[model samples]
Target: MHGLFVSDLHLLSPRSACPHIETELADYAGAHKCIVLGGDIFDFRWSDRGGHDQTLEATSRWLQDLQLATENTDIIYLPGNHDCHPDFLEQLEKLSQQSKNFSWQPHHLQLGNNLFFHGDILDAGNSLEDLQRYRRQFHHVKPQSQWAHRSYDTAVGLRVHKLVPRILHQPMRTCQRLQNAIDRLNLDDAKAVRNVFFGHTHVPIEGLKLNGRSFYNPGAGMKHMQLQPHEFTFERAIPASEIPLASDTSTKPPSK
Candidate 1:
């Protein structure tokens, strides 16, 4: 069946251009049965800022509209660490109350023979050492004070917008962890899961195969000039002729 997949919309009032995405989604949902939102739908840092309540209310209303627009389609949300706060439960409840087609799910989900997660929970894998070094180079700026927060936000925005794309594309440890996860999944013969989907790396990836299963990371919709804004859509039903006959049976390496 036809389905839409997206993540990391990071919608906030000052910078949110989500209407275009939402409009496109509505058009797709009219003909699709399922819509999967991978993670980080809201930039929690921005949403926690002043006037955020108004933004939240507007977002809620937009979601309701989406529910109405999709009619019978299933809308599944997988919260990322950014939006996985305890209070988000209440917000999700409100959305559910507002629309029958909307629903929220845990970090991991099973769809037919596929598994999905935000991918952050997989740990940084062997990259912890590198990340630690990078973290040290960039001093920890507290979010406590408004000035500090602004400075930190600006710095982060600059890094994501100006630095990441050219210098840091993919981390070795992250790729390792992903491979580890896929390996672990293959041990479960009963599950018969042959595909995995995730977000949080904010990198658009598709058609990659690890072990025997197809791997997909739809990337993020959040725009940072230095980083690419990636999105993807997939179909669940594949023709038998398209299925690979020989599959990799080797175990994935262990995560550090």
Candidate 2:
């Protein structure tokens, strides 16, 4: 079976880009057996506060449409930190009830020889570290209002643009950090799997090897002018060497 993988869609209703992504994903799902959403499927906090009810309804409708269109394909939704609310379980239950193909799973999933995670728990070389650092640096300046979320997001966007090129090209430190995380995970006898997929970096990277395993981050569906959002398809019968690697290393911007 062939599978599709995507992450960091950060979908919102008013955003035309997100709708386009949904349409594209639906088309892709027609040929794939499964679609794995790595994480950050929604910017829930921002949507809850900044978005109107129409946005919520539209997003929900889009999801339903995708579920219907991809009836033969399994849609796996993994919760990211942004969408990991206490009520997440209830929300997912509602979503599952609304669509036949849609299902919500825990942060991690094991499929055949592969282990998939939102990659937040890997806790190394993630963009979140920089984002946290910036947040701390401007904590006093940042207001406690909901608008602060947008401000922080904007700041992170600017910083990532400046840093990503340097980071992806000379990524020794980052690669080491990611490898270390993979090593720790492999230490768990039960969870020891060869292939891994993750997405916190927002940088679409493939061909990362650590301790005889491969790691892939499909990047984001949202496009930032500098980096085009990407989608990945994997064939179960195809060997690792056969997959085409992506050349772009820049982070895709959130679709507006």
CA lDDT, every model vs. true structure: 0.55, 0.54
Q: Each model's TM-score, in the order given?
A: 0.67, 0.65
Q: What's the residue-level lDDT of 96 in candidate 1?
A: 52
| Local error of candidate 1 at residue 149 (angstroms) | 5.9
- Clashing pairs in model 2? 224-253
Q: Residue 112 in candidate 1 has what lDDT?
A: 62
lDDT for each residue of candidate 2 in 6-60, tens digit (9 for 90 to 100):
7777665122135476666768775436787776676554453344444445456
Q: Candidate 1: give its CA RMSD in angstroms.
A: 9.2
After aligning candidate 2 to the native by TM-score, how far in Å is the CA of 42 from where it should be?
0.7
Clashes of each: 1, 1
Query: What does candidate 1's lDDT look like per residue over 127-242, in tens digits?
Result: 42332232232121122356655765676667554356324446444555676665544333425666667777766666566557666766555444212322334547433223
